[model samples]
Target: MQFKENQTIYLQIAERISDEILLGHYAIGARIPSVREYAALVEVNANTVMRSYEFLQTQGIIFNKRGIGFFVSPDAKHKIKEYRRNEFLKTELPRFFMQLYTLHIPMDEIDSMYREFINNLTSNPSNQES
Candidate 1:
């Protein structure tokens, strides 16, 4: 719930909520805390939380119920997964590739390393295998 100074508070709030939903702290179709409640929990202004909720609604990650609090969307899990995968590909992968290039690692060598990592991970019985 700690807000980053350079980022908008509303976007930070939205990311927190997204993390909750993705972690199953907020189950699919389950009601979310009220805006005032979340604001209280995060020690932020109610307007900030409201803006976050509205942004999430626009993303189809949550839906408002008449006279009730918002609920996690029915397709929330899938939507969250898709969103995270897109983010990983768009953001994380590029950075990783950049690091590999800086290290003078060839594309084939990187592929082989990745495959070995995956194989080692899958074969390790004590690792819980993700």
Candidate 2:
């Protein structure tokens, strides 16, 4: 995966995993790839993936089985959505609003575009996450 320079790698990995969970790539209670496995898949060190897994565990997005592996928590989707929604509202939305204001963009224009996007998403099921 492409790593963003602005965020820590481990955090980015955590976000990717959360996104996968939301997309149903890793369903609730499903086992995720092992640390070493994921590290190899992402072309990163095992320790880095471990840190990402630890972060997810703390966030209640995943749980570790003593000898088996990690599995998605039952409420992982809800937790991921709650955390991401708040993050977007607190950071991204403000920046987006600032851009809109600076460009003197009308809300109605954005609203119409947003509605069209939603329509397309609904019509194109593959574009949406489960």
- Clash count per candidate: 0, 0
Enumerate residue pairs that collide in model 1.
Answer: none
Off by over 4 Å in 1: 4-7, 125-130
Which structure among the candidates has the greatest TM-score?
Answer: 1
lDDT string for model 2 (37-107, tens) is 99999999999999999999988999999999999999998888888898899999999999999999999
Question: What is candidate 2's TM-score against the reference?
Answer: 0.75
Score residue 128 of candidate 1 by CA lDDT.
53
Best by lDDT: 2
CA shift of 26, model 1, Å: 1.9
Q: How far off is model 1, as Cα RMSD?
A: 2.3
Ten-residue region with minimum lDDT total, candidate 2: 78-87
* TM-score for each of the candidates: 0.81, 0.75
The residue-by-residue lDDT of candidate 1 on 1-130, one tens digit each, is 6678987999889888998988889998999999999999999999989999998898889999989889999998777678778879998999988998889988998789889988887898677522
